[model samples]
Target: MTNVTYKYATVLVAIQNLRNEGYNVDFNLEENCLICGDNKYTIDDFEIEQVYRYEGESNPSDEATVYGIASKDGLKGILVTAYGAYTDSMSTAMLRKLALKND
Candidate 1:
């Protein structure tokens, strides 16, 4: 995979810009998978297509990350998560796949 870098003024801009780029689905991480409405995707079901990390200048709580994701079955989405220990916990496989985003 090739690396793509983008600079956004804020986390909201990253989310909106990624949506404009066609990552329109909104995802929430469950204990073992990523969920969107009635659909659930396991670790093997999707890949992270892009990542945008934003750091807070005055407060760490403002730090966050935006992920552009696509599933094997043709679903595309976005996942917004916070940095550090406040992030939601994930199953090992799910964690491994998401960690690959940094590579």
Candidate 2:
């Protein structure tokens, strides 16, 4: 993987870890998804949730859409927060897939 990719993956992991740790973000990891902070960060328990693009026309150069599965409580909203190293042009899909396998 490229150095830039390595950096984004790191941040993604950090986000998951933070959720697991019950940080300021409110959430929990389900069997096939993660319900967190008004945002449902969707992904298998083993998958990593993150946007892989290095940059975008969006306000946040580095951004990702997180979704979670429906739970007894209900599915959380969604948050596309700014994060990771914005390189310029990169494969967001490949990066997201790689991020999922990163764990």
Candidate 3:
């Protein structure tokens, strides 16, 4: 079993890393990235961490890895993205309330 709640700090660091890279990214650890295989990260995991999206006419077939993050409603939600597929538009108000509650 994956330790979901235990990786709070690690999840935050991953998001910060993406942000520092100039990509509009967020965190969603609820997403299971190991379904493909033991110790194997699903495409969603990479997408969430790397913030990737599909190009041309074809859309992304891979679902995103979901992580726990402070959402726009002052609640935590599973973050998802596809490079350019889904960029969350979180409200600053909700942002301020979350990310530090449990930490």
Candidate 4:
């Protein structure tokens, strides 16, 4: 994947920009999949297209990441997740998949 950085001042701005770019869905991270409405997308069903990370100035708890995701079937969305201290728990495959672009 190509490396790209967006200059959105905050996580909210990044989300809005991605929405305007056609990523209309909102994906929730699951233990081994991503949930969008009633649909559950496994690791093999999607790819991370872009990642935007925000770090807090005073506290680590404010750290968060916004991911631009696209499924094989053409569905596009964004996943907003906390990093650092309050990270979510997930399967190894799910962690690896997300970590690929996060790093």
Per-residue alpha-carbon lDDT of model 3 for 9-80, expressed as tens digits? Answer: 344464554455453433432233322213333332232122222223464544333343332323222354
Cα lDDT computed for each candidate against the true fold: 0.77, 0.38, 0.33, 0.82
Q: Which residue ranges in model 4 land beyond 4 Å of their true spot? A: 2-6, 84-88, 100-103
Superposition TM-score, candidate 4 onto the true structure: 0.87
In candidate 2, stretches whose alpha carbon ends up further than 4 angstroms from where it belongs are 1-54, 57-60, 66-69, 85-103
Give the TM-score ranking, best first.
Answer: 4, 1, 2, 3
TM-score of each: 0.82, 0.23, 0.21, 0.87
- C-alpha lDDT of residue 34 in model 4: 93
Q: Can you tell me which runs of candidate 1 are displaced by over 4 Å?
A: 1-6, 85-88, 100-103
The alpha-carbon RMSD values of the candidates against the true structure, listed in the order shown, are 2.3, 13.2, 14.5, 2.2
TM-score of 3: 0.21
Native-structure RMSD, model 1:
2.3
lDDT of 3: 0.33
Roughly what TM-score does model 1 have, to 2 decimal places? Answer: 0.82
Model number with the top TM-score: 4
- Compared with the true structure, what per-residue lDDT tens digits does model 2 show for residues 1-103? 2111223444456447445533334344333334565545443322333323334457664455342222344432222334443223325543453342433
